[model samples]
Target chain A: MITVNNLTKKYSGTTVLNIDSLEIPKGQSFGLVGNNGAGKTTFFSLLLDLIRPTTGAIENNQIKVSESEAWKPYTAAFIDESFLIGYLTPEEYFYFIGELRGQNKADVDSFLAPFEDFFNGEILGGKKYLRDLSKGNQKKAGIVASFIGNPEVIILDEPFANLDPTTQIRLKRLIKELADGNDVTILISSHDLMHVTEVCERVVVLDKGEMVKDIQTSTETLQELETYFTR
Target chain B: MLKQFISLQWKSFFRSASLSSNLFFKILTIFFALYLIAMFTLLGGGIYFILEEKVQKDPLLIINQFLIFYLFIDLVFKYMMQKMPVVNIKPLLYLPFSKSKIVHFSLWKTILSFFNFIHYFFFIPFAVVLIIEGYPPGHVIGWTMGALALIYCNNFINVFLNDVDAVFYSFLGALVILFGLHYYQIFDVTVYTAPIFDALFNQPYLVIIPILLMISMYILAFRYFKNILYLDGGLQQKQQEAKTESFDWLNRFGGISVFLKNDLKLIKRNKRSRTAVIMSLVFIFYGMLFFTGAVEAYEGPVWRIFAGLFVTGGFLFTFGQYVPSWDSSYYQLMMSQNIMYRDYLNAKWWLIVIATILTTLVASFYAYFGLEVYLAILVAAIYNVGVNSHMVLWGGAYVKTPIDLTSNKKAFGDKQAFNVKTLLLTIPKLLLPMALYAVGHYTIGPMLGYALVTLAGLLGFAFKEKVFDIIEKVYKTEKYKTIAAYKQKN
Candidate 1:
C-alpha cells in the first residue's frame, strides 16, 4: 500500500533519514521501533508529506505522496499534540475532524461510543480544552481522532509513551482488533517492545535512519527484540 | 535573593530563543523604546512652558485640575495594558525562599517599571518650572510627591484588581456613569476637582493622604498575590471551566462552519485574541474624533472615509491578518485533514464579513454626529466586507510566523517575519477605499462617491469565488513552507 524509493531527508547537509527502499503491503500492521534520534518522526513526516525528502519519493497506493493529494483522503495521523487543536474540547475536536472527513456530529458521537472506557471518562464532556487535558489524555484524544474517519492508512508516533498501563493495554487491544483483516494499514512507532510485538504482525527496527531489521513477528519475537536491544 | 530574581528575569529576556532568533526585531524594539523615552522627555521639558502660557489661573492649580483626569486615564491603561510580572515560582516554592520575600521582590519590581517613571517625564519639568516661578520649593516637592504617590496608588490598585475578570466591566461601567453624569450636567466633577487639589497643594503636608493610600494599596496587592502564590491557591482554582459548547447553527455551513466555530472559540478563550476583539470594540468610538464639524466642513471627505473604514474594519486588521497562523498551533493537523483549502479561506472571509457588519452596526450610532458620517461608515463597511476581507486573507497567506497562543505577552512575540511586507500590504487595503471615495467625490458628487464605494464592494462580493480560488492557490503553494516554519519552537 505504501512504497518508499531511495527516500532520504536531510537537515543542513546532515542526513536524518536515508531509507534506500521499503514497501508495506496492503492491510499490514507494521511496527517501527527505535530509540531517540532514530528518525522515526522524520520518516512519518515524509510519508505525511509534511517535510520534503532530499531525494526520491514516497508513494501511497501508487500515487506519489508529494506529487498528489490523493493519499490524504485515506491517511490519518496523530504524531503529537500538534495534531490536536488545542482550543477545542475533545468532543468539539472529534466533531471537527469528523466533519472534515464527511461525517456529521451525530455520526462522530456514535463512532466515539466504543472508546468511553478507553477515554477513562477524562476526555469527552470533561469541560477542558484539549490543551488543558493532561498529556496522556491529549494523546488519547489525538489517537481517537485518527480513527474517526475509518481511515485506510493510520500513522501514530509514540502512541504508548504517555498512556498509563491500563490505557496501553486498551490501545494494544484496540490496535489488534482494527488490524484483524480490516483492510486498514496501520503504522505505529513505539519503544515498548512487548506492546509492539503483541499488536504488529511485522516489526522494522531503525537505527540512525537505517532500517536494521525487518522481522516477521512470532511467539519468540519479543525475546529476540529484547536481546537485540540489550546488545 | 532579589538579585537572583532580577538576574533570572534578565536571562529570560535576553536569552529567549524567540528574541535571539530575530535580531531585526530586537533592534526595532530597542529603537521603539528609545523613541518613547525621547518623546516623554520632550513632553516633560515642554509641559511647564505650555501650561504657564495657556492657563489664566495658577499654573499649579491648572495642573492639579487636570491631574485627576490624568490619574483616571493612567488607572484605566494600567488595568488594561500592564502585565503582572511573573516568575517561575515552582522551583522557588519548594526551596528555602520565603513566600513573602518573593512576593515583595515581585511587587518592588513594579516601582522601577517604565510606566511609573514615564509620568515623571512630564511632572519633573513642570515642578522645576514651579520652583523657578518663585513658588515655594517645598510646596512644589510636596505636590510632586503627592502626584507620584497617587500614581503608585493606581499601580497597586491595578495589580490587586487585574485578576478579577469582572473588574474590567466594572471599570468601564464606572467610567461611563461618571462621564454620563458629567455630560448631562447632573454632577460636575470639575466643581470639586479644583478645591480638592488646591487644598492638597496649599497644605503640602496633606501629601500624606496619597502616601498613606499608596502604602495600603501596596499591602493589599502584596497580600492578595502572596495568598495565591501557593500551587493550589486561587490562581489554580480560577482555571476557567472547560465546558464544551457547539455552535449548532453554524453546522449548517458544513465543514467551513466548523473552522468558523473553532476560530470563534479561539478568539473567546485566548487572552491575546480576546484582547484584540475588545480593542476593536473599544476603537468603534475612534470615529468620534473625526466626525466633528471641523472634519466634516473640511475640503475633502478623506477623514470621513478613513474614520469609517477604521471603525468598521478595524477588527479585520487586528485579527484577520494572522489568519491561519492563529491556528499555527495546529496548522499541521489542519493541513493534513481531508478538507479543502478553499473551505478554510472561505471561513476566514465569512468571519471578516460578520465582524465588519457587527462593527458597522455599532458605529452606526455615529449617525448622531451627522448623516454624512453614517453614510460614509455604511459604504466603508460594505467595502470592507467585499474587498478588504479578501485582502486581509491574502495577507494571511504570507504570515509565516506562528503566534504563540499560550504566551501572555501583549503582542505576538515573533516579529521578524512580520516586518515591512505586512505594513506595505496593509497600507493599500486601508487607502483603497479612501482613494475610491476621493475619486468619486472629486469627479462626480458626494452621493455618487458613496455609491461608487458601495459598487466596488458589490463587485468584490460578486467575485468572491475568484478571490477564494486565488487564495486557495496561494495557500497550497505556501503550505509546505508555512508548515516547516510553524514547526520551529521559536
Candidate 2:
C-alpha cells in the first residue's frame, strides 16, 4: 500500500535518513524499532509530506505523496502534540476533525462511545482545554482523534511512551482489533520491545537511519530483537 | 550575589532563542526603544520654555501645581503597562540564598525600571532651570528629590495593587470621581496641589514625607510578594468554572462556521486576542476627538477620511492581519486534515466583515458631531467591508510571526514583520476613499461623492469571491513555507 524509493533526508550538510527502498503491503501491521536519532520521525514526516525528502519519493496507493493531496483523505497520523489543536476542548477537537472528514457531530459522539474506558473519564466533558491537559491525556486525545475518521492508513509515533500500564494494555488490544482480518494498514514506532512484538505482525529494525533487519514475528522474534539491541 | 543575578539577566537577554532566530527584529526593537527615550528626553528639556511661554506664570509654581496630576497619570500608566520584574527564581529557590535577599533583589530591580526614569526626563531639566532662575539650589534639589520619591511611591503602590482583584476598575472609578468632582467645581483639587508642592519647594525638610511614603510602600510590596513566593502559595487560586457555550445558529454555515466558532473562543479565552478586541473597542471613541471644530476648520477630505476608516475598520486592521498565524499553534493539524484552505480564508474574511460592521455602527454615534461626519463614516464602513477586508486578508498571507496567547505584555512587539510592501498596501487602502470622494465632490457634487464612494464599495463587494480565490491561491503556494516557519518554537 505504501512504497519508499531511495528516500533520503538531509539537514544542513548532513544526511539523516537514507533508505534505498522499502514497501509495506496492504493490511500489514508494521513495526519500526529504533534507538535515539534513528530517523524514525523523519521517515514518518516524509510519508505525511510534512517535510520534503532530499531524494526520491514516498507513494501511497500509487499516488506520489508530494505530488498530490489524495493521500491526506485516507491517512491519519498522531505523531506529537503538534497534531492536536491546543485551544479546543477534546470534544470540540473531535467534532472539528469529524466535520473535516465528512462525519456529523452525532456520528463522532457515537464513534467515541467505545473509547470511554480508554479515555478513563478524564478527557471528554472536562472543562479544560487540550493545552491544559496532562501530557499523557493530551496523547490520548490525539490518538483518539486519529481513529475518529475511520482512516485507511494509521501512523502513530511512540504512542505507548506516555500512557500508563492499564491504558497501554487497552491500546494494544485496540491496535490488535484494528489489524485483525482487516485491510487497515498500521505503522507504529515504539521503544518498548514487548508491546511491539505482541501487536505488530512484522518488525523492521533501524540503525542510524538504515533498515538493518526485516523479520516476521515468531516465538523467538522478541529474543532475536533483544539480542541484536544488546550487542 | 545581586551583581551575579544582573549578569545572568544580561546574558539571558542577548542569548535568548527569539534574539538568535530573528536578529533583524531584535535590532529594530532596540532602535524603537532608543527613539522613544530620545523623544521623551527632548520633551523634558523643552518643558520649562513651554511653560514659561504658554502659561505666563511662575513656571516653578505652575509645575508644582501640576505635579500631583503628573503622579496620578504616571501611576495609572504604570499599573496598565509595566511588567513585573522577572528572574529565574526557580533555580535560586533551591539554592542556599535566603528568601529575603531574593525579594530585595526583585524590589531593587523595580527601582531601576524604565518607567521610573521617564519622570527624570521631565524633572531633571525643570530642576536645572529652577537653579538658573536664582532659586536656592538646595530647595530646588529637595523638591526634585521629593518628586522622584513620589514617583517611586506610585511604582511600589502599583506592584502592591495589581495583584488585588478588581483593583483596575476601582482605580479607574476613583479617577473618574475625582475628575467629575473637580470639573463641576464641587471639589477644588488644585487648591491642595498648589499649596503642598509650594511648601515642599520652600521648606526642603518637607521632602521627608515623600521619602517616608516611598519606603513604606516598598516594604508593603516586598512583604506581599515574599509571602506568595513559597511553592504552595505560588499556585494560582482555582479559576472560575469555564461555561460551555454553543453558537448553534452558526451551524448553518457548515464547516466554515466551525472555524468561526473556534476563532470566537480564541478571542474570548486568550489574553493577546482579548487585548486586541478591547483596543479596537477603545478606538470607537476616536471619532469624538477628530470630529471637532479643528477638523471642520481644516476643510478637506484628508482628516475626515482618516477618522472614518479608523472608526469603521480599526478592529479589522488590528486583529484581521494576523489571520492564519493566529491559528499557527495548530496550523499543522489543520493542514493535514481533510479541510479546504478556501474555507479557512473565508472564515477570516467573514470575521473582518462582521467587525467592520459593528465598529461602524458604534462610531455612527459620531453623527452627534455633524451630518457630514455621519455620511463620511458610512461611506468608509462600506469601503472597509468591501475592499479593505480582502486587502487585510492578503496582508495575513505574509505574517510569519506567531503570537503567544498567554503573554501578559500588552504590546505584541516587533515580532510582526512590518515591511515597506505592507506600508505601501495600507497607504492606498486608506487614501483611495479620499481620492474618490475628492474627485466626485469637485466634478459633480458633495452628495455624489458619497454615492461614488459607496458605488466603489459595492463594486468591490461584487467581486469579493474572485479576490478570495486569488488569496486562497496565494495561501496554497506559501503553505509549506508557512508551516515550516510556524514549526520553529522561537
Candidate 3:
C-alpha cells in the first residue's frame, strides 16, 4: 500500500506535480493517464522518491518513502530505460534483479519458463545480449525482470508503448493475473485508454501537474476519458 | 535533395560546435593543443638534430625510417580517433540527408584532427632544416609532401581497418611480422627506404609510393562510407558476458561484494578506465627497475618509499573521480529505489580499496624482484589507506563530471578542465606522504618509519566509517557544485 499526501514538485520554478492525497490499496491495478507533460511520470517518480518533493510526504507500506528504509524489498519500479542495465542479457538481468531481491536463481529461471516461446532463447540463455535484441524483446525482458521477487507494489511507466499488439494483449492479461492472483498492487501509467480500462480497476487522470479525476473503471465508460484527454 | 542534405549536415556540425564550445571544450582545446605542440617539439627536435648532419651524406635512409615511424604512431592515433563516439550521430540519420554524404563528411572531418600535425610539426621542420642547409628546394618540397602524404595514408588506412573489425588485429599482426623481419634483417625497411630518401634528397621521383598510398587511402576511406552506411555489423553487436565472479574472494569482508562486482565491471568494459589498473601495475614494474639505482642515487629509504608510493599510485585519485557521472543516467532510478546514499558511497569506497589492494600486490611483487621494495609497498599501501583513499574519495565525491562511460574519451567528463582545487589537493595528498617518509628516514630510520605508515593506515581503517560520513556530508552539501563540475562543458 502507498499513500502520498500534500506532495508538490517544482523544477526551475515551474510546478511539475502537485497532489493533496492519494492511496493505492494492496492487490489492485491502478492506471495513471495523462497527455504529454501531464505530470503522470512526475507523480510516479515522486512515489518512488526518485526526486525530492518540494513539500509534503509519501508513505509506502507504512514507511515514509522519503525518510524511511521501506519500499526496497516490497517495491520495484521501472521509471525508464535507465532502470535496465543495457549490457546484461535478459537472463543475466533477471538473475541480477533476483539476487538484489534475495530470490534464488532457480526462482528466476522458473519465472522465465513460460515466456521461453516468446523469448525463443533469443533473450535468455542465448548468445545474444540485451543490447543485441530488438526493442520489443528488450522491453519484454525489462518488464519480466521488473516483476522479479513478486514485490508487493510494481510501478511501470508507459509499459506498452513499443510492444506489438499481440504482446500488448499478452502483457495486459499478465498484469491482470498478477494483480488478481498474487495480491500485488500494480501502478501502470499509459496513454492507451482501452488497455487501461481492460486491466486497471481504477484510473487516475492527471492534467498539467494536478490530479483532475480519480474514477472507478467499472462506473466510468470509455467515452468519459475523452473529456480528460482533450482538456 | 542533395543540397538539402548538405545543409542539414552543416547545421548539425555547427550545432555540435556550439555544444563542444562549452567551457570544458575551450580548456581541453588549449591543453590538448599545448600538450601536442610540446610533445612534438621534444620528439621532432631530438630526431631532427640527431639526423641533421648525417642527412647530408645519406638522407633517404633517415627520411624513410622517420616516415615509417610517423606512419606507425599516426596509425595508433587514427584508431583512437575513429573509435570516438560519432555513433551518437545516429540521430542525424532521420534527417533528409543520404547516409553517403554523412560518411563522406565524417571522413573529411578526420583530416581536421590533431594527429595530422606529425607532418606540420615534425616532417616539415626536418624538410625546412634540410633545405636551409643546401639540399635543393625541389627535393625538400617533394620530401615534405611525401612525408605528409604518407602520414595521411596511414591515418586513412587505420580508419578504414577500424571500420571492419579485422583491420586492427591484422595491422597488429603485420606490425609483429615486420618487427621480426627487421630484427632478423631478412628484409630491411631502412635499406628499402634508402632509395626513396635518395630520390627525395638526391633526386625527386621517389615520392610516388607516398602519393599512391595517399590516393589508395582516399579510395579506402570512400569504401568505408559503405560500411558506415550499414552500421549494423558484428562490431556493434559485441555483447557483455554475464559476470560469474566468485565473490568468495570479496564477500568474506562483508558489505564489499557489490563493490567488487562494480570494480570488475569497470575494468572489463571501460577500455580507458582499464588504463588505471594497467598503469598501477606498470608503476610497480618501474619501481622494481628503479629501486636499486634510486636508493643509490638518493641514499635514503625515505626517498625510496616516496618514489614507490608516487610511482605506484599516480593514477589512484582518477579512479573515483567519475562516481556520479558514471551512474548519472541510472542515478535517478537507483535513487528512487531502496538504495541509501550511504550504501552507494560505501560501494564506491570498496572499489577504491580493491584497487588499492591490487596496487599493493603489484608492489609486493617488486619486493620479490630483489629491491626490498616490499617495505616501500607496505608504506605506500598504508598511505593509500590512511590518506590517499580519503583524498580520492573526497575529490571524487566533489567532482561533477557526468562521464558517459560508453564513450572512447577517457573519463567521459571534461577533457581539459582540471580544477585548481583538484590540482592543489594532489600536492599535499601525494607529496606529503613522500615528505613524511623522507622525514622519518632521518628521525626514526627505515623500519620504524615504515611501521609508522602501516600503523596510521590501520588506524585510518578503524575509523574509516566516520571519515566516510564526514566526506558524505561534504558531498551532499556540495552536490549541486559537484554536478556543475561534471556537467560544465569541458
Which of the numbered candidates is closest to the native, going by highest TM-score? Answer: 1
lDDT of 2: 0.80
* Each prediction's RMSD to truth: 4.0, 4.1, 5.7
TM-score of the second chain of model 3 compared to its true counterpart: 0.71
Ranking by lDDT: 1, 2, 3
Real A-B contacts recovered, model 2: 0.39
Q: TM-scores for chain B, in order? A: 0.83, 0.81, 0.71
Q: Tens-digit lDDT track for model 2 on B1-490? A: 8788888778877766556655665676567657767877777677777788988988888788777778888887676566566666667889888888888887788788778977787788778877887889999999999999999999888776655526855776777577658767898687888899999999999999999999999999888878877654542322333545666788888768988888888888775577667657766766655776444544565567667887888777778877887888877787777777788888888888888888887786788877888998998899889888888888778666666664422111111222322333466678888888888888887787888888989999998999888888887777777778888744
Ranking by DockQ: 1, 2, 3
State each candidate's chain A TM-score. 0.98, 0.98, 0.95
Model 3: per-residue Cα lDDT over B233-318, one tens digit each: 41243444554333445556554454455456555665445544544554555564356563355555566666666555645655
Q: What's the TM-score of each model vs. the native? A: 0.88, 0.87, 0.79
Stretches of candidate 1 exceeding 4 Å from the true structure: B1-4, B20-39, B47-55, B95-97, B132-134, B193-196, B205-209, B234-237, B241-244, B268-272, B292-301, B400-428, B435-470, B477-481, B484-490
Clashing pairs in 3: B24-B489, B24-B490, B25-B490, B60-B197, B400-B482, B400-B486, B401-B486
Higher-ranked by lDDT: 1 or 3 = 1
Backbone clash total, candidate 3? 7
Scored by lDDT, model 3 comes in at 0.66
DockQ of each: 0.76, 0.54, 0.34
